[model samples]
Target: MFFDKSHLVALGGNMPSAKGESVETLRAALDRIASSGCELLAVSRFYRTPCFPPGAGPDYVNAAARIACDAAPEAVLNLLHRVEAEFGRERVKRWGQRTLDLDLIGAGDAVLPDAATYQAWHDLAPDAQQSEAPDRLILPHPRMHERAFVLVPLADVAPEWRHPVLGRTVVEMRDALPDDALSEVVAL
Candidate 1:
C-alpha cells in the first residue's frame, strides 16, 4: 500500500524477553510492526553499544527501521509502545535497561507540539533530561542527533532524512559528533 509519509523507529534491547534472545525479540517486533499497518521499507544492521549510564547493564543491540504509514504520529507511537509491551518492556526507571525499546523518531516533516517546545526539550540539561519526560510527543526526536546508537543505524536506513527543526540530514548529524562518540556502536 502507498503511504503518505515515511517514518523512522529506533529499536534497542539489552535484556532477553519472554521471546528469548535480544536479537530474536527485535526481529519479532519488526514483524509485529509490519503486521500492524506500517510498511517495512528498510532495516539497518544491528549494532552493539554499551548501556547509556556506562555500566547500567549489558550492552544493547540497536538498529533503525524506515516505515511508510498513513497513521497519525500519535497512533504510530501507540503502536510502537504496544509492541514494546509485547516484548516485556517496563518503564521502571528512566533510561533503564530493557528487553525492548521502540522509539518513534520522526514522521515525514511533521513536528509535534511546536518548534519551541521541541527545542526546549532538545536542549534540556543532562540532569534535567534524566529526571524528566515530556508530556507529549516530540517530532524528529529532539536528541536524535546527539546519540551514536541512534545515528549509526539510522544512517544505514535513512541517511538523507533531515530533521525538520534542525535542518540537518542524518549523515550530517552523525558526522558532527566527536570521533570517539560512535566508537562503541560496532555492527553485529
Candidate 2:
C-alpha cells in the first residue's frame, strides 16, 4: 500500500473557544476540516506542547492531520482560516495564545510562489522572525524543520511525507531535533 500525505494540517490552541477548551477546540477543528469536502486520512495523538518563548501562556494542544483535497493551496488556506474563525480564533497577535490554529502545512510537495520566496522566510533570523510575518503563505512551512511541536505530531501521521525543498521525510526532521526540543512535545 502507498500512503501520500502531501496535504497536511497542523492544529494548535491554548485557549477556550465556542467549542470549548484547547483539546476540544482542536478536535472540533479536525471535524470542521473533514467537513470541507476533504478526506481526513489520519490524525496524530493530541500533544501537550509548552508555549513558545517559555511561559507565554498555557501549554497548547497540538496535532497533525493528513488530508486529501483537490482545492488550490490558497483556497485551502482560506478554508483553514475560516475554520479557525468559527472556533473563535482572533488574529490579534503574531504568535499569541489562540482559541484555534489551523495551518495548511503543505499540499502535494508543491512549492508556492517559488523556492526563492520560500527560502527567504525559511532563513529568517529568530529575532527577525518574531516581528515579521510573511505577507503570503510559505509552504512546507518555513519553520517546520525546527519545530518539534509541528514535526512530532506530523511524524505520527506522515512520517514518510517528504519536504519538497529539503528532501527530508517528516520523521527525519522530527528525529534530528535535540532531545530537549523533542522533550517539549509530550503526548497527551
Candidate 3:
C-alpha cells in the first residue's frame, strides 16, 4: 500500500445543508473514499466546538480518523482537495467558513520540510515563523505541539503518538498548554 503507515485525517465545518454542504455531508465524502479503496483505520470522537474564525457563526463538529491507502502523498492531498470541493469549500477566504474541511494531518514519516510546508504555515498565520527547535514540516507545527485541536484528540486515539520533531507524546503537549489556551478548545 502507498500509505503503509497510518494517516491522521481531520474533518470539520457545519452539518450538510439541503441547498448547501455541511458537516453531515462528510459521511458521503468518507463513503466515497472507502468505495475508492482506502482502508479505514480508526475514527475519533466527534467534537462540537465554535468555528475557528470566531464571531457569530455555527459551531463545528470536529473529529479525527485514520486511513490506509495506496496513493502517494501528493495524490492524497489532491483527493482531499477534490473532496473539499464536492462539499462546497472555496478558496475565496483563507480559513473562512466552509461546509467541510478535510486535512491529511500526517502520512507516515515523510518529512516534507521545504518551502511548500512553510508556505502552508504562512497561509495559516502570516506572522507565524518557521523555527528550528522542534522542526516538523518546516517549523511552527513542531510535532503538533502548538495545535491543541490536533493534539487533544490525537492523544485520545494515539496517546503515545510521538512528534517526529520534538519527540514528545501528544499527552505531554496537551498538558503543557497554558490553561487559558486549553480553554480555547471550547472556542474551536
Top candidate on lDDT is: 1
lDDT of 3 by residue, 69-98 (tens): 887766666777787787677766555667
- Output the number of the TM-score-best candidate: 1
Query: Please, what is the whole-model Cα lDDT of each candidate in the order they appear?
Result: 0.91, 0.88, 0.62
TM-score of each: 0.96, 0.95, 0.75
Q: Model 3: residues >4 Å from true position, as ranges? A: 1-4, 15-23, 113-143, 183-188
Report RMSD (Å) for each prediction in the order shown.
2.1, 2.8, 5.3
Ranking by lDDT: 1, 2, 3
For candidate 2, the per-residue lDDT at 3 reads 25
TM-score of 2: 0.95
Better of 2 and 3 by TM-score: 2
Cα distance off (Å), candidate 2, residue 113: 1.2
